[model samples]
Target: MIACGLLLLCFSRKQYVGKVLVALGFILLVISSYEGISGRILRSLESQYSPINLSQVMAPGGSATIQDSVKWIVVLTSGIAGDATLPYQLQVSHHSRVRLIEGIRLHRMLPGSKIILTGGTGFDGSPEATTMSRVAEELGVSRADMVLEVESRDTKDHPLY
Candidate 1:
């Protein structure tokens, strides 16, 4: 839509605004199409060579055993920010994300280990603890099994708070 509008304007002697709009539209189009292209290529390649299950690649023998003697896991959780209702939309940082999912994967190897999920809805939206609970369920832990602290907001009270 914007591309066509820009084309019309470009042909009508409005070179500056037309070129700017064309560039903006082109950037948006390229960004949108890039996801489709990469997704399609990845789907094709996955169909060709990748295994149907991810566990086959990550773990070989399904030897669910932790390397060291770890009994408890602590996960600092946060909410994801959408495009609207935020400046940059702060979310749980990538380091914290990895500490969660991958940490869950590792914790699964430890028998009788408990997962402690901390953090609440710092923003005025959904609570982070609720989302983290869902993630724990997805990672094979039950809601009854997770220790969730829903009121936590600041990191200063991470261990005790």
Candidate 2:
């Protein structure tokens, strides 16, 4: 950025007044990234929560086999768009319907376990609970077993999930 600004100093020289433009560009990038703010919030919230195993989270890295004897099967809501299906969508997203399917199958542990969907924000800036609700219903998750908490976009913060 400093180099680019110096180049722009074709008008004069990049350090028109003590590298002011370069400093300004860096500040803009930092502000636009929202880097520290969101990261700090997430880190604090994560640390506050009692740590659970990867199996506890629906994240892709774990292979823990959830047994049918388990009475409660809570799953994090997959935040990907429900209406999408294409190569690009799959390529770009770590969230998949397959994870939901697995969660549902694992959740069919007798009549006690329930499903919890935990995300509620959309790319279009709309609320997302309705989409999760629709998918649960479509997948034949018992309406009674399905619990929706549309208020939070963070699954880790959602207790049910």
How far off is residue 130 in model 1, in Å?
1.5
Per-residue lDDT of 29-146 in model 1, one digit per residue for the tens? 7876887877987788878775224353234666534424455677887455542343321344555566678657756655566788887665656666666666567667876667
What TM-scores do the predictions have?
A: 0.47, 0.45
lDDT per prediction? 0.64, 0.59
Off by over 4 Å in 1: 1-69, 82-93
| lDDT of prediction 2 | 0.59
Clashing pairs in 1: none
lDDT, model 1, position 30 = 86
Model 2 alpha-carbon drift over 4 Å, by segment:
1-71, 82-96
For each candidate, how many residue pairs have backbone atoms clashing (under 3 Å)?
Answer: 0, 0
